[model samples]
Target: MIKTFKSSLFLCAMSALFLCSACHKEQSPIPEVLGEYLKYHAEKGKTADGYDAYFDLSDGMLAAYSNDTTKAEIKSIINKITGNKNCRNIYSLKEGTVSKLDKSQTELYNYILNPSSYATVAPIEETLKRITSQGTSAFLVTDFEEYSNGVIQQQNYAKAYFVDWLKKGGDITFFITNYLENGKQKHLYFTVFDMGEHSLLKDIENALEGSKSKYTRFNLTANVVDIEYGYSGTKGGCYHDESGEDIVSVTNESGEGDCFTLYKDYHAEYYPFNETWANIVKNAKDLSEEGNTPKFMHLITGPKVNLTSLSGYNVKELDLKVTNIQDDFIRFAGYYEYTKDKTINVDENGKLLDEYNYPNKNNATNMPEIEDMLKYAGCVQDGVATLNVDFDKDFNGTSSKVKPLDLLRVDIVIDECEPKYDLITKLFSWEGNNSLEQAVRNTLQEVNPEGQVIYTFFMRDGGE
Candidate 1:
């Protein structure tokens, strides 16, 4: 998932406001919005054991009116007192600690730290005062974070919907954080903007109404399992075998004898020695002519040891297998042998191995024509490759069906300077301000100035 944070316009406003009122005497504490948010966390009683900070507003204190100097001073004090540790779970709702905000603003604060983030259109102060904005329009802002953990851009898709709701005589603002954090089980934060005038009570009511809007939530748990394989030797044990009656063979106590002799006197069991059993005799001429008897052997009842655990055995030769035949998801579990002697240095001329790669062809014409060229744009399962070049229909219009056989050269615009034979989405992303096709055109001309760009344009066509 992309780990980017697309900032809403509210962030810009907040920055400007902070710079404006960062410094001043008789300053206030953390904004009431954040204060109330901390209070909520405190009330929940789930906050980790640490310093908990809060805030209260002073008279004539304006969140939008603070100077950078005062803000900096306050931040400095917070840094000095809290150091690197979080505020202990103590609610310090003081006016001079941080800027003061209103109850709705507090809700906005909660929304930010909550995964389900969105902005509203009511001044938090007015909301706290139980006032409402009549005949006023409000907007809900939704933002996204990118894969590189950067703010790419703020989206305004919700504005039209928000305006529609407002024009319908909606009297409240609702914000919610319904998504689960993806990593590190960290806290999520959001900032709700008061884009319109309205009463706090009505805002809450509206929020409640909008609570029925499409919402999604998720949580994840991690589980890990491990398995490993190895050899053993039996000491102070003599191999023995029980023979039938009538034959009582005897052997000296010195242990030198044939199998039958030892079986009767010393009760030695006659068993197959090893895998490469050449002869029962230790120094037979034919056995010597062959090779040394295998050292390690296997037996169902005899003393046996895992060869992997034995000394001098190369552990790297071991193999592992994992299979998932019945389950919602496939699983893999295995471990490598950790014997120190198993490590071996390879020559510099050794070739490196890879799991996946496209064929390195000299020219596109010589390459095999992919059944679906779009599917193998960059040779991987990238999404951008599958983008259809034919203009099937206009997307921006009311009609949803694509006109049959309407083929046009589509110049899919994207952020990439070079068109890769990868999946459509991976090859190029239309994440920035320009249209995908436009971006593609600009990038294409830059790369191939002499050749004409071959592609169709994506548009609603207005005919739908």
Candidate 2:
């Protein structure tokens, strides 16, 4: 059976390299980033949840191998230090390659430095060697390592041993799972931390309690964690109060005392562009009114799925809007709105644009496979415009199999240019196989050729 890699859970196994190293000296300074992550987990538990610790030894190794610096000679030194005449076990080399000083060596070195760039069938180190042996750019492939149990233990030891290493500066982030293999579910927990303070942790706790996602449901009890307590076995799922009783049933799921919220707290931190886009829109309106300047408003459009509480439940369509109002910033917001109908002209000889077509997408939804779920509407104006969509009926289904057709469609209208905005719009199509979120990214990239993307995932249901 194929394991469903839920977007919210089950990360592709990345290398165990990011973890701390146990073989380090006690006086060595800990990488501040790892420390912040640990503190966040201990205090907040938001982003730090389920994160296997990693210590980046690549920088040190690279420094040792630098061409100019004679401060350290890594290869020969390490070879003799192991004292094993056999280099095979000490260093994993590429196939058909006996030495690390061959043409593939540079490729392997690049892969080791940036393992995240390549897709490796094995850990970063082993995978890099394999790819390099094929006489190709390691950058040409995907390389990520799924941390193993041994890696996890090494990480723990690094944290324990390298207390000084963490004294350096770094930041922390966390991820929360909608569901794990175990039936454990509760208000989502996450945390962020810095060298000087633990407020990020506190903020994460608060966000968890205040998160709008229904998946953030916690159990109640002393040893048990929940958003609702006291009334689970007695009253209904929600907590209730007695008539002026000195002591009421201790069932208050919203963290009766001292509980923190995850999303509510870190929402701004994660979604920095919320106000940035709003401000841009407001400024554009003011400018337009003052000078009658014709400004272009672009909304990068795409699909949104509301997978909140999908276990034996139903939901409604979740509407989303992506607006780029300012320079180098974009905002993606989820809402409840009527699905808008949009039509675009495709000539009798229509050719797909390369920009809108994201080639590496493994999860692209085919039109035929989702024919019942999606509806193809028109090729109007003598084949000038074609419209098709798949929408969520209520966005209430537990799986994507039962969503409404025409759920989300956005037209990014460029407002101003020496070149006509219409000319730019013609260069791209809102209807494509890419997800709504990706569509937004593509649209924004066109508007600001140099702009960076800032995306946020949200879900809004009016029925609630």
How high is the CA lDDT of each candidate model? Answer: 0.21, 0.22
TM-score of 1: 0.13
Please give, for residues 1-464, the per-residue lDDT of candidate 1 as tens digits.
21111111112212221222222211121122222322332233122222222222222222211333323323332333232243222121122232222333335244223322212222222222221222222222121121112333233322333233323323222232322222211111111222222222233233334233232211000000011111012211212223311111111122222111111111112211221111222222222343434321111111111222111111112111111111100000000010111111112332111110111122111111112111101110222122122111222211212221111112222222233223212222333522222332333233321221111121111111
Writing each residue's lDDT as its tens digit, candidate 2 over 272-369 gives 11112223334333433434323222111121222221211112222223322111010000000001101111122442222112222442334312
Q: TM-score for every candidate vs. truth? A: 0.13, 0.17
- Per-model C-alpha RMSD: 32.0, 27.0
- Per lDDT, the best of the predicted structures is 2
